[model samples]
Target: MLLADGIHAVITDRHGGISAEPYTSRNLGGAVGDDFDAVLRNRHDTAVELGVDPARVVMMRQVHGRDVRFVTEPFGDDPPPLDAIYTTEPGLALNVLVADCAPVLLADPVARVVGAAHSGRPGTQLGVVPALVEAMATRGAEPYQMVALIGPAACGLCYEVPAEMREDVARVVPEAWATTRQGTPAVDIRAAIEAQLHKANITDIRHDARCTIETPDLFSYRRDSRTGRFGGFIWLDGG
Candidate 1:
């Protein structure tokens, strides 16, 4: 959907490609033990479906850190170990692959800057989204003018975590602290991200509330350890 004028965003599910079981169809991640050829094909198909040039799509080798990169073209064979990426060039789509981590898409239509980030428990506590906002600002984007989309991820009720882990993350982002339906410690990564965005002065935020762990149509590492990954894509119109 359109996040703003000229900015397009999409969150894909685990369907429509040509992979086998486990990574069964529409798996866009390349490092999840899926066939490399199938992954390439799935990537191509996803870009085609989005009306974008597959060769221009960029993917990251996410490391659950706050590192961000500015890109103008595809990363090719070896993508860097970064959690966020942005581009000022139109048609150069930025892709974030995730099974349970929140996929974040951001755009400042007035400045023509677009960014995508993989914000999991670690990345969220590390302030990856805030780092992304800072990076985009260097390219003439401002948080007040940016629109953000938090894609499907493991919700708090479904993302039970160890008490210490929850406490650690909550220390960094208190909004992440939560209690699951079963009354166990949990971290609401997406909620934490929203809070971060709000703190950055970004008010036009949107969300795909489907919890990956609860939604069968979506990929979830917490649900199935050996699972495929869906994608969240964002790009500007016109090449």
Candidate 2:
């Protein structure tokens, strides 16, 4: 969906590229064992489709922790280890790669600040989503004034986990606690993240609603051990 003038944000599905096999056509993840050149070409082509320069894309190593960083410039291919990337500077887009994890895109049109985040069960339990909101707040983005887009992820019904792990995450985010389709304990990472954003007063949120594990059009690391990752991007226009 179009966020606003000068703000470009979108979530890519696992299609429309040149990778083969498990990666299929569209694979934005570089470290997922896809051919380096194919991955690079797919990334560049995706950026070109978005009218952005491939070199200017800002991404993270994404350690599934609470580390959030601000971007004033590009960091090339070797991005730092962090879960969230925010930018007030125009022309620099933030990209978040995900397989079963939630990819969050933030935009505050009034403040001209945008951010992208990758959050899984660990990140949800560790308050990474709130940290990204706080980072945006420091840059003049009020929580209520911003809109967040939660990309596709493994749903609660499909994301079964250990009983202890579910209990651990549920302690912090009760909204995430759930039972899988087969009556197994599970954690809905996206639901937990949305709850966090709501607690921070960020109520304007959208969701892609596609489950990675259930959708063949999207890649799922849990479903395919060698799967490639799709991505979501957020940016402001320099012009």
Give the winner by lDDT: 1
The root-mean-square deviation over C-alpha atoms between each candidate and the true structure, in angstroms, is 0.6, 1.0
Error in Å for residue 207 of model 1: 0.5
- Could you tell me which 10 consecutive residues in candidate 1 have the lowest summed lDDT? 23-32
How would you encode candidate 1's per-residue C-alpha lDDT over 85-204 as one tens digit per residue?
999999999999999999999999999999999999999999999999999999999899999999999999989999999999999999999999999999999899999999999999
lDDT of 2 by residue, 1-239 (tens): 57766788888888999999889989999898889899889999999999887778887898999999988877776888899989898888799999999998988999999998899989889988899999999999988889999899999999999999999999989999989999999999888988998999998898999999999999999998898999999889872
In model 2, pairs of residues that clash are none
Model 1, 160: alpha-carbon shift in Å? Answer: 0.7
- For model 2, the superposed segments whose C-alpha errors exceed 4 Å read none
Model 1, runs deviating above 4 Å: none
Question: In angstroms, how far off is 222's CA in candidate 2?
Answer: 0.9
Lowest lDDT sum, 10 consecutive residues, model 2, at 1-10
